[model samples]
Target: MMTEQDTEILIVGGGVGGVSAALAALERGRRVVLTEETDWLGGQLTTQLVPSDEHIRVETTGRNASYARFRDLLRSHYRAFYPLTDEAAADPHLNPGAGWVSPVCVEPRVILSVIDGLLRPFVSAGQLTILLETRPVAVATSWDRIDAVTFETADGAEIVVSASVVLDATELGDLLELGGVEHVTGRESREQTGEPSAADTADLLDMQGVTWCFAIDHRDGEDHTIDRPARYEHFRDWRPSQLHGERILGFERAPEHAGDPARAYLLTPNPDDDPFGIDVDHRNMGGAPELWTYRRILARRQFQPGFFASDVTIVNWPMNDYIGGPLFGTPDAAEHRAAAKELSESLLYWLQTEAPRPDGGAGWPGLRLRPDIAGTADGFAKVPYYRESRRILAERTIVEQDFSVEILGDNAAVSYPDSVGVGHYFWIDRHPSTGGHPGGGGRPQPFEIPLGALIPRRVDNLLAAAKNIGTTQITNGSYRLQPVEWSVGEAAGAIASFAVAGATTPRAVRNDERLLAAFQEDLVAHGAQLRWDSALRW
Candidate 1:
């Protein structure tokens, strides 16, 4: 017999946001159903193979306490399991993947393990159901509410889930399209949102590049080179004119100033191995930095002698950024998806065959693809690292003015009275565009996550739980990070649980000040940071 299960909350994507939402709902004694397209639950961290790219101030400012707990659990797990050197074990903040990108950089699997731990108790209690390798096929919307969502499993079996509240936490906001939620995609004109840094014309296909990141390990005398990708030459020689006319490979980068010429560097040199310097000078500055250590998942220096021969780093660099257009939602989705994958594989091929090395050599054959590390046979990530998503047309659309430092001036960020949570990422650092038009970057300030952003103006029982929240094409750049997504999810989950139990819609909660305040207080109690302090004053 076909299965049709009913739940209190249905989260339609088992990514970082969906996982957070599920945890929040489960904690509230709500029966939750969550589905993921991939086997892995952690999206960018695990399946996408993109290590944490966070701000430097995270050490002092910290994130939502729930996320903090997860981070702590990861470190604690490493401390308990790994054979750490005295020096390594002595340090309190142990970065398993001592990558320069983020202080808490670790392998995707390490994070996946911790996430499993977070869900196990709820799973055992029968409050949560995790459907892996499942995807949303159809949605049953009754007037304004999403009544049921049908998903096809890996085994071709169909499972339908009915819920009071549905959360669209899919990576690309897939449910928005499936459920016919009013959403926007790609570049919005400066006229559309009325903030600086937006394009002059709306280009629906002009979204940020998606990187199909892959992890690798280097062993000197080992040649684990796979077959040369089909389009290796295309990516090697193909540098967008937007890149100021330089090859995609090598240290080639377009100058921050558009009129300036292209520049090349093997990697940003950091003799001190200081992460602060890297974050300020290279990472936050965009372009490219020390390629190898940019997102190293496992640094040999972090472990004891002979424990690791070389570091394992994932390449999500300029060369591999698929800037052809928004592939997931557009008409050319399948064709572009294949091209994106080819672009990544081809970049890897180029790295193994023709990349310039500091040692006065071309290509390092020893740089081997580690399929086992990322849990993918081809060594590429299980999914692409999407920097943008189809955002909902909400009660409030966060434009550049709310957070851009240039526009907001000394304030840098504006506060929302109906705030649900808080997130920090200074600046709108947009990556390469699909049309080969590079977008601008500017640092913003710590921003509030307004509850209105999560509430679709038209949808009654649906809430945006991931990058699908109300954000313009420009503002999406900053709000689309790891911590911000978690905050969004946590808030959505909490609000959904409350709405489901209280017999009200997300819209009702936002409109009612008392209910909103109560929900915010509950979020604060459960580790959702609602606002910044005077110390973070811009």
Candidate 2:
């Protein structure tokens, strides 16, 4: 017999957005049936094992109380489990990784535990039923509403979930296609979006590259070489056409920059390291420093003597990005996926055998991959860190005019009457693009998420709870980051709860000004952020 479930909210995809959505719905007393393709929750945080790539203002401004609490919990976890030095422990703000990229960087498991801890209570009370290692097989839609979602478990059991509201929080917005919801993928025309950074014409299949992040440690004078990848020779000899003439493994310049391209950083060389001062700090990581410390998960100095061997860093750099093709929604999707994974392996090989060392030599033969952290014996993440998703053909697409700091110049972000949440990130970045588009992207202003964006134009009961929200290709870059995705999911969950409680459809609640205001109030009560302050306003 097939497993059948009924809930008020059906949240698909257990990544950051899915987990956040579940939490938000549970907080609102909504019964939820959450499904995850992977056994673990916290997609980017856990399955992908990538450290937080957050904005400098993470400690203050633009973040919600719930996310802030999550950060505090991560710090507390380190203090409780690990042996931290007195200075590191007593410091009110303890960044576990001490990574330069973000204020709160910790192991993926730390976040997984925190998320599971939060979800356990809901599960115990039977308010939330989480189905792990399950993938959605079919979605049934009646007229304009999502009637039910069906999934096939790993053990070959079929499960059907009929819910009042269906939130698509999947990594690649798998629900968008399964439910026959209209969506936009790839680059949008500059004229369509009026985005300065947009391509001149629409390129439907062009999307951001996905990275298979993996963790590694440095053991001086020890050899920890991985078996050379099957496509090692090809990747080793190949050069990136997008980065001028630089080898894929070597220094490269942004397409915008033509000079001698800046060099890639290394674990041993310490070229970007501040020789005399502290290497890790909360400074703007715009230079080589960003690459070097971009994903360092564990800083040995923070712990007591002999507690750690060497600093374990994660490999999620431009060098490992697979721009050969988009992962899903393409004919050769599986091959492209394999190529991306191989690229990551090639990157690890280069770091071990070809990357230049500080001693005027090449390669760090001692560099080793940490399989335990990545949850794979091969050292690659359990899942690729997808940067973009098939976004819903939203009622209101976010244009550059809405959030580009270059355009807004200090003006407050354009306000939305149905604002459900708030977030801030760079506009466009490292797009794994086709047709040799630009590499680095434009800086962006903070932005407000309107309820209209979450509601698909024709899909009555469905909601976009992740990067699948209403955003143009240009806007998707920033909207796809960690914090912003979390906010999007939170907003979706809140909308679902409010709609069920009011006995209204998603469109109806969004259209009613009074109902919309009440929903926003509920978001505030549940620790979701609704707005930024006046300082951000010009």
Candidate 3:
């Protein structure tokens, strides 16, 4: 039997975006039903095991108070549970003198707990109903409005949820596909958007591949050789020239800046002394050792009693990302995803059996896949970190010209009159250059969020909250990141609340300046960074 529920807002994908939208909508006194494919919340934080990849400037002392609040939440979690030295807590950069991209190093579980705590209020208030392990299978829509969302649970039980507005926060823009929403699936050719370095024509199939990240811990003097994965031999020899060595785990630049890219060397075992500051040649120990060392450097002391330890997460190894060459043009997408997963598992197997240790040993067979560490049963990210999705064919598609370094260089970055939120992360990463696109990488110019990006051209009650929002191929690269996703999600929630209150639609919110101002005020009240001020610059 199918169940039916009614809410003022329907938020899909329980990730950062979905949760943020739920929180925002709840604050506006609207009823929100939030659903996640997994049992846990905090998509990137909890499930992905990715210690939030925030821009350096989005930390505690950064420009936005909301961003600071998030940092404070992380710090508070550490303070409440883990006893930290005053020196550690008082440091402005969180790590004091340590020059890391993010200020804090937190366990994935802690983040999950914090996110749960944050959402508890709404759940308790009865304004938010959180359905774990529930996925939206179908969207009941009219000609221009979504009437309800149909979700299926783990047991195959279906529930139809009716809402005034629907927010698609799914990792891969699942709703956009199920709802028959107009969207772009793969890459757009450079010619379509006139992006200076776009490929000659669009290739909807050439999407950025996803990664299945996992954490590893090292113990000293233990032979942790699990077993060589079935496909281990193939990956052993798999080296893309971009890696600069035989190891695929090493660093490379963004595709746009292929020449003279910043280089990152692999980590090797230094038993006698700490090789903390020393730079050495021939450091590439294939790919396995470097992957372990990358994690070790983050928290050397965490693996006490062992000579050295780390919470090493493999991001760019051969196991995941199934794009490029024949794989890119494959007709069977599911097969590609399966192949990618197998590849990642193979990489994991090699790391456990053949990876070099600091004690000059081979294979840390003791390497365990920490599902508890990642807050999921799969020992991988709860959901694949989707880089691109079916973006809506919005009325006002934001193009690269609006935020290009060559065009807006040294000028005030494009500030949308209907700016919803603020974000700053490098442009699209790890995607291949197709369709005659320039094969290089460069720093992305700062960009803004316009109301049109959140509003569908014809959809009356649906809004995109993450990478699924309306954007050209070139522009999606710049806007798809953790902070920006939050911004989009936040805006979607605010807009939903405004529409419900005014008995209007998204288009009305964009067309009415007074209503837009009210919405902006509501955003400010909820700790969102919507506008830029010179004095508030980071």
* lDDT by candidate, in order shown: 0.81, 0.81, 0.65
TM-score for every candidate vs. truth? Answer: 0.95, 0.95, 0.85
What are the runs in model 1 whose C-alpha is more than 4 Å off?
A: 258-262, 267-288
- Return the lDDT, model 1, position 43: 89
Which residue pairs in model 2 clash with each other?
209-432, 405-445
**Which ranges in model 3 have alpha carbons more than 4 Å from their true place?**
60-64, 92-99, 239-264, 268-320, 324-331, 352-367, 426-430, 433-440, 534-538
- Model 2 spans > 4 angstroms off: 252-266, 269-283, 290-292
Q: What tens digits encode model 3's per-residue C-alpha lDDT throughout 191-220?
A: 677767566767777666566677655454
The true-versus-predicted C-alpha distance at residue 478 of model 1, in Å, is 0.6
The C-alpha local distance difference test score for the whole of candidate 1 amounts to: 0.81
- Per-residue lDDT over 511-538 for candidate 2, one digit per residue giving the tens place of the 0 to 100 score: 8888877888888887777777857632
Q: Which residue pairs clash in candidate 1?
A: 323-434, 426-444, 427-443, 427-444
Error of 1 at 308 (Å): 1.2
Residue 387, model 1: Cα distance from true site in angstroms? 1.3
Every model's Cα RMSD, please? 2.2, 2.2, 4.8
